[model samples]
Target chain A: MHTLDVALGERSYPIHIGRGLLDDPAPILARLKTPRVALVTNDRVGPLYLERVQHGLERAGVRCTAVVLPDGEAHKDWPTLNLVFDALLGARCERSTTLIALGGGVVGDMAGFAAATYQRGMPFMQMPTTLLSQVDSSVGGKTAINHPLGKNMIGAFYQPRLVIADTATLDTLPDRELKAGVAEVIKYGLIRDAAFFAWLEDNLERILARDPDVLAQAIERSCRNKAEVVAADETERGERALLNLGHTFGHAIETGLGYGEWLHGEAVAAGTVMAARLSRDLGWLGEGDLDRLVALFERAGLPVQGPKLGAERYLELMAHDKKVEDGRLRLVLLDGIGASRVSDAAAPERIAAAIEACCA
Target chain B: MHTLDVALGERSYPIHIGRGLLDDPAPILARLKTPRVALVTNDRVGPLYLERVQHGLERAGVRCTAVVLPDGEAHKDWPTLNLVFDALLGARCERSTTLIALGGGVVGDMAGFAAATYQRGMPFMQMPTTLLSQVDSSVGGKTAINHPLGKNMIGAFYQPRLVIADTATLDTLPDRELKAGVAEVIKYGLIRDAAFFAWLEDNLERILARDPDVLAQAIERSCRNKAEVVAADETERGERALLNLGHTFGHAIETGLGYGEWLHGEAVAAGTVMAARLSRDLGWLGEGDLDRLVALFERAGLPVQGPKLGAERYLELMAHDKKVEDGRLRLVLLDGIGASRVSDAAAPERIAAAIEACCA
Candidate 1:
């Protein structure tokens, strides 16, 4: 088992990564303020692992109320979020009742947001059950729901008390979703960690084959990189924006196609490609660097091209992105394979050409 | 002009109370990150002050987009909140766009919550037009929307960049609304400021008559007391709960009567009486203390008796309050006229009896 702490002062929490970690109640019990919790999951993950997690906590004398939401990113909206609130209020859950999110990114994001706003705020924990969530969403305190204009347009930077990334859950993740998760794993490398990028390149095949050791190593490294960045810039006033490397473009793809059409990781993979192209055009990245970034994503079975949403449409959708400041679009573009910068200086024409060039 | 800073470290902000603070743009301009703003107001307050506030900002070269919502607490819900978001997204408002809430508590709360969630967070300012808002909601970072099940069930503790409490605006406030605002003004004194409570006793008629100096003094004192509490306990962990001395019961009254039926302050006024009764029953307050508290509320033209909602219903509604912990109903009850503490030790029957005694 590996544990990484996100240092956010009083808001700081730990990320525990290992196999079958969910089978234990001690780690989660240590962080809870009370013995009662509202376990928020989805129909898919709920049927598979809800009882196991619930029974474990119940046996340990913790009261658990299960709220099973419909699975998918499309359901990550206001109406869906209200369902969590409805169930919580129905059960008379209080501010001290710990809220445990027990699914992937969508579930974690929605549940975390519910915790952030439920009675002003409540204690929350995450038991991520997907590779994308385990490596990415599990570490960052960014919790939000999708809006018609943009993805994560409405949310909060609320940290969890604990994050348990039980690697065994990945065994049931669909092949496509697992590859999608790799997209974010690669993001850490492109944004800040060069050595981790190289390591991922060397172990891409094994990671794809569900090699526990390799996968665990990737999750740990990704979390470590994320925790450091979050600790330094909790509110994204500076270096933290680098984490959104492909997110601005990725959000456009997600919104442009309508959420749930493309998995978040898949859109992010394609968005990273577009960002790489833009970085190359800006002379920030060498042609070879772009090739290597693309090759790793391609090798991981992730999308290397965005859907055929025209450059103009993509630009329109991207304009609504949270990254836009004072009417200027600020994008996280790679300066090199292991370096990135948030730049609003990219010309619209260059961004458009990059978008056009990367589209299917 | 009187200014009180709610010391919240980095999130600290100034509350400007005066006769015509809204007429000048300098104070607001000093805190704005950008000259662009989305002014959220209700139809009632908008027709009177929106153009004046907008014109003032426009004269200073600030671009303002006005979103007029239906007036009243009935509209302080998710659907009303979405209107603010729709206008923001429609205007392509970015994270830097300052959201100025230009009305009473409902506008301030919904707008503040929108600012807290819009684009993950945006700069927010409060231009509170009601006396109640000026003294209470304007200082605390508590922003929220009412749920059908409970008041402020969904919300955030988002502070504002600046708060402009224009006493001039209160000149146009309705008699009932002005009395409503007085309920909160009296709260600060009852909780921690016995002197302020005595001042209200001496000059209650002058404040109700809209004497500019008396109103300004009342607003300043109320804000000062609120700022001190909020700065010390931002998220209401301990001391801050005392600030909600009447809010849990008040929220029950509001929810029981259907929101907006009894203005928030009116409900709070009656709720405070109930809390005083509960305190007396608990041997925390003498009988004379309860009578004095009731007399002040009555003199202020506020409801001293709650609506005849059955005690069982009030208890049921209060169970869902944010103050509830681990299924135990924790309440802010008075130890005396000027001191209060949150306690769950009051027997359920005692609480029910208090509610029954206080209701008309």
Candidate 2:
């Protein structure tokens, strides 16, 4: 197991990455404020591992209750989030009862937010069961639920006490989901780690084949990059904006297509291509660099093109993005294969053209 | 005008307590990151002051939009909160747009929570018109909505950029509400300010008569006490819990009677008497001190006796309080007239007897 700490002063916590970590309760037990916890998962992931985790904690004399929400990003709204609250309140869970999230990004996000708002604030832990969550959403403290008008429109920047990334769980992830996870893995490399980008290019097939060691290494590297960015700019005032390299466009696609139609990483993959195209038009990235970026996403079996939402519709949806400041849309565009920056340099015409060119 | 700063480091903000502070937009303008704002008010308070505040900001060239919600504590729930989010999203309000809450505690809380969660967060300002909000809720940064099971079960500890306590608005406040506000005013004195308690006892009639000078002085002192407690412990780890002296029992009464049935301060007034009775029963407070506390409530036109919900029901409701930890109920008991501490010393039967004794 490899433990990397996200240095956030008093909010700092360790991210544990390894195989079979979920079956072992010591890491979670060590971090819990009390011997009681409420585990939040979704219908998809809960049925698979909830009993094992519950029994494991119970064996150690820790009381555990499970709150299984409906699966999918579409369910990531207030009504679904309230299920967790209803269960906790119904059981009379106190502020000290640690809330453990055991699932993918949607469950983790909803549970983290529930912990953040429930009883003002409560101890939260994340046990991400998918690669997409392990490498990105589960590491950062950004917890949110979608609004009909925009994705992640209502949320909070609440950090978890610990994140348990058990790589063994990835074996159960479907091929499409695994490929979607790689989309975010590629994000770290495109944003800052050029060498990791090359490493992914070389070992994409090994990761696809579910090689345990390679997968763990990739997860650790991605978390290290994210942890550094979060530590430096926890609230996304400046440096952290770079981490949203393709998210501005990606979120538009998700909201435009309706959440869950395309996986988050899949939308990001297509959005990254659009961002690269716009960056190329601005002379920040070369054609060769853009081609390589697209090729890497395609090689991982991810979508490299967005849905057929008109340029105007995409722009309108993107306008509602959290990154929009004073009505100015800030896009994270690639400066090179290994570097990116939040830019307002691209004109509306150029952005529309890029979106049009990259759409299916 | 008295401007006192709540020292919370970067989160610190000034509380402007005086007449007509809301009409003058300079303090709010200076604190805003953008020239845009969304004013959130309730039906009851909107007709009274919404246009004046909006016109003041608009006249100063600040783009202002108004979101008026249904009046009363019953509406302080998710559906009502969604109205604010809907208005903001509909108006395409950016995260930088300042959200000014221009009403009482319900409006302030719903709006503050909206600002805290809208697009992860936005700039929040409090224009507290009611004396209860100005002297208590507006100063503390405790924003929340009530759950069916408990009051403030879902919320956040989000501070505002500036607090404009317009004492002039209190002229329109009803006699009952004015007395309701006094309940919280007396709370600050009972918990930590013996001299202030004595002052309130001597000048209670003047405050009830709405003497501008005495009212402002009372609001300033109440804010000073609350600000100190909040600044020292923003998340309510220790010292801040003392500030919740009567809140546990108070929340129970509020929840038991079905939110809008009684004003929050009225429930708290009755709760305070119950707490003092329990404290005296435990030999922590003298009989005379308890009588004085009840006398002050009676003089303020507040309810000193709670509704006959039965001690068992009150105990059941109080169990769901935020103060409960590890299945143990931590009650804030008075050591004397002006001193309080969180204690687990009272037995359940003793608490029930005290509740029975204090109920109507």
- The fraction of correct interface contacts reproduced by each prediction comes to 0.96, 0.91
Per-residue C-alpha lDDT of model 1 across residues B81-136, encoded as one tens digit per residue = 99999999999999999999999999999999999999889999999999888888
Q: Where is model 2 chain A poorest over a 10-residue stretch in terms of lDDT?
A: A320-329
Number of the top-ranking candidate, with DockQ as the measure? 2
Q: Quality of candidate 2's docking, in CAPRI categories? A: high
The top-ranked prediction according to lDDT is 2
Q: Model 1, stretches more than 4 Å misplaced?
A: none
Q: Each model's C-alpha lDDT? A: 0.92, 0.94
**Residue A73 accuracy (lDDT) in model 2:** 98
Q: For candidate 1, give the lDDT of residue B2.
A: 80
Q: Which lDDT value does model 2 have at A74? A: 96
In order, how many clashes per candidate?
0, 0
DockQ of 2: 0.91
Q: TM-score per candidate, in order?
A: 0.99, 0.99
DockQ of 1: 0.90
Error of 2 at B333 (Å): 0.6
